[model samples]
Target: MSAEDATQGLGIDALLERERAKLDRLTPARAAAAVELQGALLVDIRYAALRERDGLIPGALVVERNELEWRMDPTGDHRAAETTDHDRLVVVVCNEGYASSLAARSLHALGLHRATDVIGGFQAWAAAGLPVTGAPNAPDGRA
Candidate 1:
């Protein structure tokens, strides 16, 4: 089935609830503080096309949605070797908040219990007038 069809009949709210159950969520403000004080790893799960269409956060890691689970799980064979030291906080993000929430929860399942998503994703961060970088094509100087 097509992506839209798979989610047919189930509204966005339901999908969000399903995701929320498995994930921790944070607002843009909290995410920013976590980045500054706790050294949380920011993972942008938006597609490459989206990143090119709208710039990325300067220091955020690009883990693409498909690879997120494998990369964060230290014990999984597909886990990125670099994450063997898994004590770090991990924050996942997508274009908006929906997908990232689900992704963050998946990371939690992999042992990064601190994993969470920005409440409004990049847009919210930009809307809050927070600092951002990498959106060369973005209009209004935001990403």
Candidate 2:
């Protein structure tokens, strides 16, 4: 089948479901623990405005969604310091989680087999009482 034929009936929701199923998506608490104890890298891909509005996880790497592939590709010259190897566990986070799943899938395409996304994204993290900084506007002002 042609490329267009392959996706002829697949809408964005279906596509999102398919991509999420291929990942071992993490909960907010588990994601925090993985980053804190298991050496996992939590990457935040939320745009600047959302990040500014929602605050940020203490150590999550902030890379734009457009730059995610290059910045997190372990073998790429533009890789981040934490983009150590293909085996590293990469947990991608977006504003509410949808984009992160797709982003993780892209990382997998780049040979990063361990890439995944948080189930509920940054909003979930903040709701779960996880640490957030610079969020003066947060409901409880966790900043």
Candidate 3:
């Protein structure tokens, strides 16, 4: 489908269901535990504009959604040069949860067995009153 056609409102429930089936989702509480245990690589997949509009979670690795697969796969030559390890757990985040879920699943398909996405995305994490820091434009420019 064309970009416009693809984006044409697929009701929230339908979108959520699709995400649920493809992704391993974690609640903010669970995500917090993963962070504390240092078992997850929290990947923020939101566009830079959205992150600037909202606030960012401190320490979240900024991997844009489109580049997630390449960045997370250590065996793939396309993997980011900075990524030297493949076994790290990955928890991806998007504006809501859809895109990140998709991204996380892609990572899983790439063999990062521990990849998943936050249940409600950044909004949910923020709403849960989780620790978030950094100025609005600290990481300026979209991915």
Model 2 scores a TM of 0.92
Which residue pairs clash within candidate 1? 55-134, 55-135
TM-score winner: 2
Arrange candidates, best TM-score first.
2, 1, 3
Error of 3 at 41 (Å): 0.5
lDDT of 2 by residue, 1-74 (tens): 36884869678898899899999999999998898899999999999998887798898999999999999988
Q: Once superposed on the true structure, which residue ranges of model 3 sit more than 4 Å away at CA?
A: 1-19, 77-84, 135-143
Per lDDT, the best of the predicted structures is: 2
lDDT of 2 at 127: 84
lDDT of 3 by residue, 16-120 (tens): 576568666899888888978975778898988887788778778888877877777888777765455767777888988778777877777877777888988
Q: Candidate 1 on 16-112: residue-level lDDT in tens?
A: 7877876658888888889889888888888999888777787788888999887778787877544655678888878888889878877777778
Error of 2 at 24 (Å): 0.4
What is candidate 1's local distance difference test score? 0.79
Estimated TM-score for each candidate:
0.79, 0.92, 0.75
What shift in Å separates residue 11 of candidate 1 from its native position after superposition? 6.3
